[model samples]
Target chain A: MNRVSAIDIRNVTKAYGPTLVLDDISLKAEANEFIAFLGPSGCGKSTLLRMIAGLETLDAGEIHIGGRRIDEREPGARGVAMVFQHYALYPHMTIRDNMGFGLKNIRMNKAEIDRRVAEAARILEIEPFLDKKPGQLSGGQKQRVAIGRAIVKNPDIFLFDEPLSNLDAALRMRTRLELAQLRRRLNATMILVTHDQVEAMTLADRIVVMHDKKIQQVGAPMDIYARPANRFVASFVGSPPMNFLPVSVSEGANGAVATLGDGSKVTTRVKGLTDSASWELGLRPEHVRVSDQGLAAKVEFVERLGERTLVYARLGDGTALTAEDEGLSRVKMGDTIYLKVDGDAAHLFDADGKGYHTPEVG
Target chain B: MMSPKARREFGNFLFVAPYLCVFLWLLIWPLISGMGLSLFKADLFGGASFVGFENYSRLLQDPVFLQAVGNTFYFVALTVPALAIIPLFLALMLNRATRTAAFFRGVFFSSSVLSVTIVTLIWRMVLMSDGGFVANIIGFFGFDPIPFLSDPNLVMISMSIITVWWCLGLPMMLYLSALQQVPQDIYEAAALDNTPWWKQLTHITLPAISRTVVLVVIMQCVLQFQLFGQPQLITQGGPNGASRPIVLFIFEVGFRRWDIGYAAAASQILFAIILMVTLAQYFVASRREGRGR
Candidate 1:
């Protein structure tokens, strides 16, 4: 934790055959920081994590850990431990042996290895199953052993590749919370790769959103959710992602006025873009409310959950839109409701799907 | 479920009818007949007389039969270890050969497909005295040409070599299959843990394949004890009967001498030895398994 940078990746690139999987990726992880690589499937997040683990070779850049170059080092020599997605526990060994295997290989004394293994088992709450083999343990217990194996290594950095993807939904939630707690307890630099947005949002100190093998934005989860760098980030970070609609703008006496497809004009303050022909408007479903003074719409369908409901409606030009409402509010399938748009919290995207500054606040 | 009292035992008999029929006709009946025949003295088509344990008594006193036992035991001792160890060595190499593993596995296993007679014929010529590959190679080293098939001192070794060459492939295939069952993740974990290759082999690979090794050793012992083809074709149990074996001697007694009772006794002895050795192997393997866990 005393090191300036626990992991410093510089201009790293990787290719698998003809496919360019990772391109010019660079990031510096601070000591004891918890970073999550969040992306959709096949976005090269796991590949980048593997590169840092020394499991995969870098085609073009340098990776340094604890201020030492480790590009050519083997996985064992890199001073990093990895927990694989499959929970790759040795089938033949008991839980005790599995946790102590790495220490034994490193030539730790018998008593020391026993102590470290015992300590890890206690931390993971797997002491009861120490004598049982991995095959005998349940899924959650096996995953705990996998974590214990890495924890016993006492490495500077821990690399996880979608480690929770195999668990059931409930177990995944509980295990993720435990992992967050474990990270805090150990104060070790940890990097996690996962496609689940909720996991990333809940677990990461700073989330790095990746798309098409490039990092789009890096920030706290709520910050990225509130202010995404691009359309992809805005779409990927939310559960029901931000909505987009094509709109036209013109200069009026007060400022710039935007007209929805339904001819409902809303005035907004924005800089530049004086010559653009058209723009796309983005807003989260939670940001917009069903108020009496906004654009009018007919609700096509209402999906009622226990806590919230999603009203799928259409604008005047038949453009589909959705809004969130309390589940207790009884709206039938065909009920018409007054829809409202909060112009300040809304976003404006240029032709290339990139979000920029919006002047007025809601 | 049916009541235990109403579910008659006839149902069990009906379920096992086919197996019982085949077992009696193929195995039990012949075994009983053989044992019965060994108790009486008879020629092929002549009337029999009770001889009690006379044939067995004579068998114990016969030097030739004793020699055959010694020779067969020597063959098993030489060939069983080779069969067990060499195939496993070759299998390990093939399993670890990342690039050409399939090709080398096929090559090593190719010999198992050949019939034993064909294999013996091939090696007989290869080990012949004058122009054989083995003799010529020895001559190239400025050493005397080994009388592989003719010399009493060398015939057992030569026959064992042929046995090993012919029988190695199957055990190698078994060990290879066992090796494939071992998870690659274990080895990767070991590598990441900085376990050396030799240590990994000793602690991981060896233990993982122990069952297969035990199976290979038992199978090799049984097969080698029944050694016949190489001695019959190459040396014809010659050079002071050094290459003679128990199965060949029984064949000589039953078919050549036409003394069915004595041959049956010899056959019983051979069967007894095979059974004892196989049981011993099972005991040893089960003991190891118990200890390993």
Candidate 2:
């Protein structure tokens, strides 16, 4: 088996006139790997996906798939199939025709096209709706037909550009589960671009967190969640964003200790330079435990969400911090409590918003 | 509060009164009058003779009425296809144009807003034998100027061209509007399917706009059956009456010769021909719609 790479996109940049959309993005996926490009809207995530699909031309670098240069090829010759955000199903054709459309276009034998379409319909569990036109199908069923259209092509790489965004929430969840199951079954190289963190986390083998036309971090979902490379990712990935606090760094005999704006100091094993000594302390809501040994803050409001509660409060310096607690816990508004910032699990960013590597305390 | 029954009745009357007024005076009255007059003979000065079936009997021996009927069919055959196919082609070309779509759409549809007199006058000047723009352009190519309007064989062609040009813009605008109704996602889906442009035009674009095509074809055929002004103004019924359409013949018999009874019978024949053709077109359209469903 040729295991070099399914798709290798090198320094691909796209621009529309004076607007630079994707600024020097380079990405790759090994054979049979599933990757997700996760970012906020207008972050060039979809642009990179379209570049790999040959739907959009790259302005700067080149693209290769299955060891063949494909920057100059049309989308049909790129050995790739894409499922668009709108599903883009042909309204005039039935599901069967939609599935068999690409094969028919390439002039494949009638029997072969039928066979492939049938196989795809079976795999997507849409055989019963094969003869029904796309207008008759539900939103989820239309999306399945769109995927079935891609599947029958038997492409080496599958690119999905937010295909599940159009569905309802419950449908989105179910379809995402099915897509994850499909990736496991097919083992083809699949690249999905989504702004939904939950989708990227649940479906991707590796999630590439992108911001401002550059990749911030690329790793397994949990790994990136636990250890974001910079301040932008730390705030971007969580449900309630990570809290950032200005801190003063002082070099002591033990090492560097960061003093928070709330007058609470925590000794850290991280070292700071003499030139630029201030840092921004980052802490996730889930990591901060409500206890008696940490910083003190007054609870401003409490949001009870059945299984969990969010305590929104202000620190001594009037900085708001949200603490997630169990749903059954009864914490009244305006109640003062010791809100701990787990310094061991905390992160620090330097002046330029780049994370300063902190050696853990032994 | 007004009752629901009264409200519904008022709304129904409101919706239908506009059509009913025009339909009664313009269509129903004329139809009933023509049927009643077909049995009797009448002149332009309100002088009438109670002749039972005499005008209808005389219609059987009238060669001009037969030739008018035949010529009406010929004009329909010529102008209908020209009207339908040329406008459809223009619409397709306008649809394919990305840069100047609005400009061309405006230029094309502007013709439909012009008066019929202006249209006929313009074509009359353009198709003039010696000094017309068309003849001059042909003469510059070292070719002798052929008589477009005067020649018997060419007069019908010239009239058909003028009819096509004058009526072409409405259907082009209509087809353009219908083409706009087709969602662009369908075309993108076809592109993603790797269907070639020609196949997509055949399967996707054709089926999508087939309803408009059928409607335009039937309407154009009915319009062409009433052809008069272009042939009358440009050819004046031509050398040896080669371009004498049924409407022109009806005018000549009714007004020029004071033979209203003969013209009425001839017009009834033309109406019967139009009715048959229209019914045939509707039947075909309904059958296609059934098959499509």
Candidate 3:
């Protein structure tokens, strides 16, 4: 047990011939911080994690662990341990051996290796299955063993590549909680790569959202939820993501006024926009209040979850928007309803997809 | 009178009938007949006579037959390890090779396509004691040409080397396919765990492909036990019968000396030895597999 080290990545770029997989990505993780790389599939978040682990070669960049340059070092020399998406536990080795294998290779004494493996197994609650091979364990048990393997290495940083993606929903949730607890217990620097935003939001101290080979935004989960950096982050980070409606802006006395696609105007607190610039009003489903007097929309479908109902509606100009209503609301399909936009909570995106936030009220 | 289900079952039987006929006629019948033949005295031009266990007992005391058995065991010891190990190493090297992997695989495998006779002929020319390719190279290096095929001491070694080269391809391909089947992420995980390359080979690669390794070892044992073609075509088991193999002895006793009964007896003993060895190998391999799981 040594002091956990920070990870610094600078100007890393990777490509497969003509197609760039990761483009000049730069990020840093403080010691003992848990960071999540959150994105859609093929977003190069996984590739960036692999580069930090030294599994994928960087075409151009430098990565430092504890402030030592590791770009040219062998993967074995890099003080990191990875838990693969598929577990990747050796099929032939028992759980004990799988956890101790890397230690054995490093020529650690037998007693020390055993002690570390036992501690890891106890931490992961996998002590009962230490003698069994990976094939005999449940999917969740195997994942725990995969994590235990990383733990026994006592690496400065732990890298997880969608470690819970294979489990069923219930098991995924349980394992995710266990992972969060493990992070607290170990207090090591950890990087998690996942496409599931909920996993990122729940497990990470900070979430780095990526798309199309570049980082879109990086912030605390609540910060990302409240003020997404761009249209892509807004759309990608939330479930049933933010809805967009084309609008035209004009300078108003208080802030700005946006004319919706249906030619209705709403006063918005969002500022620093040119009057002639085309903007889109970004509103989350929950932010659009189903009031009696607002923009006119006809409901197309209703998804009634236990607590809330999602009303999918189309505006007068055929622009689709979803609004969250009370579960007991009698808004049936084809019923006309008015969606009251909370201008303070809504976001404004220009044609280039850059988001403009409202100034905080004193 | 047949029901539809019964008729369908009979139709399924018909599908395998052709293969079954060939199998019984060519393989099973000969195997049974050979076992029966081992217990009696039969000559080429005389009536067969029952001589229970006589041929078997005589072979036990026959020095030439004993020598051939020892020679075959020696060849197996020499070639089987080489066949099992060299190809695996080559496969590991070729596994990581890109762009030229297919070409190298084809080149290495090309020698196996040649008939045993053709392979032996080529090696015989290369190994000739005078004015041969190997001899000339040694001579150029200021050393006298060593007899590869003629000397009694060097003949078996030369034959083992030739057989190993001729049959290296199949086992190499087996190892290659097994290596490919190992998931790539496991290696990546190992690398990230700081396991070095060689340790990764022993701890991960070899254990993952242990089943295939056992198969190649068992196959090489069976193949090298029957060593005949290399020694026969090149040295003709010459220079004091040093390179004579059990199968070659069987051929000589049955065909040249016209002692079919003795040859059959020897063949039965060789078969029993191979069966025992293969079964022992399987038992060890399966036991290891059980412990691993």
Candidate 4:
């Protein structure tokens, strides 16, 4: 965050011999923005990040930084620093030497290098361990050292390749908070690649959802969460994912009506609906609630989380879905319950997976 | 009753007691008696008397003993560095596992398994003065038939070359494994830092494997110190004792001349030198390791 620079990736495509990894991919990240690329494994997110960092050569495309072309430049010359997934700290060097190594390789002034390293150590609060090697530090400390190595460079942009994936859950949460605080302080143009959706939702100013080697959606965190661009985006961005049901759409009294798999009809507010087309009704678990009178379902299981209880049930037509009940409710397996869905929060998808959403209620 | 701590200590000692027993009886007893024998003048024919440091003093002026010491050091200087450096380059070239790498690795390592007798026999055919393979090559180049093993100047070089060829496998294997231990990500990280290849080798690779270098030096030093069979079978310590190492001198003095006391004195000196060199290497390596490199 030391100095801000926008990144412009233009139609970057990559392939490994016969298999294509990314196809016609392009993205733009504004200066001083914390953008995350979230996807499942092998979704081309990490590969695209590596391409931007100059670790991988692009088969076809160009990248520009701060309005200057950097795709042809060497990695170090492009003013970008990356923290690798494994924290790639040099085991033979102490923390000070490890942080100062790249500077020394670039032939920077010794005094200036030392000053930068000391300042980075101060910022990371790792001054006490400057003389310690990587073997002596805990996992969290080594991760901070890896970040400090990037920070000492003071590059125009910082790239993180799943930097938190190796940590245990508690440490990962703490490190995520620290990273959020760091971003607030530095204002650096940072691009992070991760498969964890919660990390993307909590830390990113914007999330770029990727699937099957293509960018599915790019927007603010909540915007993408509430209104995904497609089926994959809807499923990938939320925990336990959005549920889907086969539905037949037709003109109703007020608008298009979706006859669900279990023969229940829900009115939709969709415009320019394609008549006589295959459709899918997507419902979030929260939108489906246990009520006295609604579509009947047999409770397959109940998960009693601290804040809420989730009921997994199957409809009369044997279509499985999840509904939320009161935390203190006595719902268990092998019980029948009625589920009422809020159609206003539901989504409709066509055969091609394009989404149509209900307008937000004022 | 013994204290509990003493009992536990006795149990730990008993775990290794068998090995210690063999070591003490076979190694320690001979070492102490040999040092004691060095203080006397004795032969295998039962002629014995107290000579004190007389034999040790005689050794300082003995020309053959001095030449053997010098020649042994010369062989060490030749063999140790060659065995270290050549194998390093070879290991680097063979680091990637491929069909061709496998073929060449087998070819290079096969020489190490040959017995010294067979090795000398093979090399002697190529180095024998008149009708050898190398002498024939030299003759084809309009040069006189050069004696490889018979000449004082060439015999040490010939022996060093043969020993290095025969001992190349272990160091190369160690270096290959060390190189593999350095993950590919480290090099990728270095490349992103714009580190040139030579700088990466010097600053990263060399420092990472410094312990292996020290180990190769120490191991080769100890191995090369016991150089007898090659010189004994090939040159017979000929051409004015040019290639006679310390071990050969000990064998001749102890067995042929039956001057056991004099041979024991020389053996003690050789043992002391090896111990000092090994201790010096260990001291330096441990100090560097303490600095976390």
Q: By lDDT, is 1 or 4 better?
A: 4
Q: Model 4: runs farther than 4 Å from truth?
A: A1-4, A17-19, A67-72, A253-255, A271-278, A359-362, B1-61, B97-100, B125-148
Weakest 10 consecutive residues, lDDT, candidate 1 chain A?
Answer: A268-277
Taken over the whole model, the C-alpha lDDT of each candidate is 0.84, 0.82, 0.90, 0.89
Report how far off residue A284 is in candidate 2 (Å): 1.5
Model 4 chain A lDDT-worst window of ten? A268-277
Candidate 1 per-residue lDDT over residues A1-362, each given as its tens digit: 32224889999999998999999999888888889999999999998987777678999999999899988888789888888888878766788998898888888999999998998899999999999888788898999999999998888888888989999999999999999999888889899999999989999989999999899999989888877888899889897888887889776564556778877876655555546556877888987677665766778888888788888877778878888888786766676677777666777677777775465366
**Which parts of model 1 are misplaced by more than 4 Å?**
A1-5, A248-279, A290-302, A313-318, A357-362, B1-20, B96-99, B290-293
DockQ of each: 0.43, 0.53, 0.67, 0.48
In model 2, pairs of residues that clash are none
> Which pairs of residues collide in model 4?
A1-A188
Model 4, position A176, has a per-residue lDDT of 98
Considering the two chains of model 1, state its CAPRI-style docking category. Answer: acceptable
- lDDT string for model 3 (B226-271, tens) is 9888888877778788999999999999999999988999999999
Best by lDDT: 3
Estimate, for each residue in A1-362, the C-alpha lDDT of model 3 and write its tens digit. 55779999999999988999999999988999999999999999998988888888999989999999988888878888889999999887889998998888889999999999999888889999999899999999999999999998888999999999999999999999989988988989999999999999999999999999999999999889888989999999787899988988888886778898779987888878754357988899998878899989999999989688999999999999999999788899989999898887878889889887787557
Can you give the lDDT of residue B125 in candidate 4? 88
TM, every model: 0.88, 0.90, 0.95, 0.89
lDDT of 4 by residue, B74-177 (tens): 99999999999999889889988699998888888899899999999999988887788888898899989887787899889999998998899999988888
